[model samples]
Target chain A: MHLEEFAEGNSFIHKLDPRVKFLTVIPSVFAIAAMKTIAAPIAALIVCLILVILSRLDLKKLIIRLITVNVFIFFLWIFLPFSYPGEAFFQIGNLIATKEGLLHVLSITLKSNAIVLLTIVILGTSEVFSLSHALIHLKLPRKLVLLFFFFYRYITVMHDEYVKMKKAILIRCFKPKSNLHTYKTYAYLIGMLIIRSFERSQRIYNAMLCRGFKNNFPIISHFELKKIDIAFGIAMIIIFFSLIAVFENTFTQVPIWIYQKTLALVGQASRLS
Target chain B: MHISEGVLSPAVLIAGALLTAGGVAIGLKKMDYNKIPGVAVLSSTFFVASLIHIPVGPVSSHLILNGLVGILLGWMAFPSILVALFLQALLFQFGGLTTLGVNTLIMSAPAVIAFYLFSYLIKRGNNIITIVAGFLSGAVGVGLAGLFMGLSLLGTGEEFVNIVKLVIAAHIPVMLIEGLITAFCVVFLKRVKPEIVGA
Candidate 1:
């Protein structure tokens, strides 16, 4: 399905080791997730935007990705503004938007976007195989690592098989609708996929056995831990700290100022209604 | 449907992560080397199936299939779902790292529950009993997942009361559809490949 579009690029971020990206991006995401203040997430968002541009992601595609990632935040918008208990920010019809509620949603929106962008730039740009390999180095159990490797390897194979079966159903003039028949059709299709996969697994196991498969997979290649990878990793750690440390005072001020300015314009327009 | 990153509190995130870590540990420990290929391929199938969007009246929703996954893999559903979710994040960006622990627990813990509750029942029951067990397992898997998601979000603040209610309510259609499909799928499995489910 041509997934992992960013993995094909060779930007500086892409050139960094997958293990290094994992080490840095994961903790950075946690730091972003844990940040309480509004300004902190704004700062994190700006840093992530810059990193995404440096990683050479397409602007249009990035926007599309952000919109897709905003589904949960969208739900927050629906309920938070009117439901939170705080000083009223504004009013529309019968509902009053709480200042605290709007502010909280804003911070969450920024934090969510920033974390996703950072992940796309850092881990998303690297080959997934390398990331799986990095898991081995990160001291995950060997079986778990091998399981991930094989799981990733077979998803596309199973997807292709699924597509073919769907086509066969289509040839039979099968029309899907909101009915039990449609649900049953899909159920049988999924059941067939499972059965096929089981048979496929048996063949795969036999093939491995014929090749003298051992309990452990032999590592033939290793990722060279380059100096630049470490330097870049440290740089990201510093950026992660600034998400909270540098924004301590602007913590409560800047975001309110920023939102108040925009909402002020909206407030003016709304009063005329 | 997984929770987006940054919405969950650190306490909820940490507790979820620790619990999931234990589950994955036990899951990995129990897995035999020979079963790796079987578990991997089956996990992949579930991954692909989850990507399929089926129409439910006016709207469409993707299949979750954690119920089916649980029925098949038992405790192994822990590691299986963990890997599948990790891949989903990398491939489709449906989820990310920070929420991985909570999301995995939300999906797989229910799956394990479904496994233990229905695996033996489906294997031994009559046709009607097997169907009922399958339906119950599928619905319960999704129902429990929704409850866990609400619980984790509740950890953020009580202000999330409305959202929590909405999340659980939103899963109703999914639960019913999951139940029906899993029931039919189980019937098909028993008829076509009894050994696969019987074992």
Candidate 2:
């Protein structure tokens, strides 16, 4: 849950305006998702890897994050290959894995990994508060931005409160069993947590009011887009569109060539018979 | 039930985002200034609620508690769920940025439904009826969320029947567990702090 662990870096990727990075990364993700051919996602994945390297993210942490994202994709591969109907590429006993199914899995895997990597390289290098500020700069609603700020500030505090409650339960020798007692205990635990958090919220509200709190979040830092950020944005758009064009042409031509070859074989067989 | 990026078509994503934006706007408008801290606190609780594993018979499931949020916050559930989901995506990558709209809709829409269906019963009923209403709200909230999650996956070319059956089947245990949790919370609040329950 340590999302901003990499935000302290002085790397080039870290130095770019959060808004520029956000704009660039979101479109690239959309492009990857919209891609019809596997090649585009593969190309996107490579681009993301290059960005990750440039960002100088810790290799171990990056791998752990990648694994978490890929685990769901791994489950998709297990089910989708058998469920999607297409040319059977292989069979084991009764189950058949189709070519289209495998391609589906590959596409999702590549697209998801590419996006996750880009997110880690781009948004991961910026603080959440700065990102919220950038969103505000982009004309996102004031209320939504404030929500993000409060959510970010108190997520850890609430987590610690839950942990403390869990510890208290454990201290009383609460063993988790497959019985009603365990369920009720957990229910009560959650109930207690909710109640405590609510009471704390009232106190927090009172404290904020005492300090002349307003609905507006005071902005401290301003983002200025540098020349490198503009260059990065242009490069992303160019690579994105070129990959789309190249892959779309290649994928479109491939099916037509296969259809023609099949027709030729069918014609030849009929003539010989 | 978080849908990863690239799983949904562009049209679905855009539609989900637009609907969610509207929901959040309504939620913000309805929220009082004094209640912002409460919403923030609940939002943070929700962000961590997913990490709290509840033991259900032989298996353990994480708490979503959207029903609790719904019954307590009403229209504010939209913005509350949005912030919680945003943090979840940022911190754990539970859902992707591209699919945030879809995920928010899948989770919070059901919560709003639960509020309308059961919040009145919890407010006006006796203790036993209140608990039952709370349980039903929690279970239905989860069931509707599962249905919505399945619907969102329709763009993947899967049959609606099969996806719904699968999603609901996976969530059955969660529904029961959350029901018990929500019921207990409701009952406890009624006894000790009845005013906060808005009863």
TM-score of chain A of each: 0.88, 0.87
Docking class of 2: medium
Q: Highest TM-score, which number?
A: 1
Residues B1-199 of candidate 2 have per-residue lDDT tens digits of: 6888876778888889999999898999998777778888878877777787777767777888888889988889999999877766665666888888989988889899999999999999998899899999889889889888877777656723444566679998889888887888788777777776787
- Tens digits of per-residue lDDT, candidate 2, A180-221, equal 687678767766767777899899889888888887766666
- Report the lDDT tens digits of candidate 1 across residue range B1-199: 8999888899999999999998999888889999999999999999899888898989998899898888988889999999988876775567779888889999999999999999999999999999999999989999999999999988888889999999999999999999999999999999999887864
lDDT of 1 at A96: 95
Error of 2 at B99 (Å): 0.7
- Candidate 2 residue A166 Cα shift, in angstroms, is 1.6
Give the per-prediction TM-score of chain B: 0.97, 0.94
Docking quality category of candidate 1 according to DockQ thresholds: medium
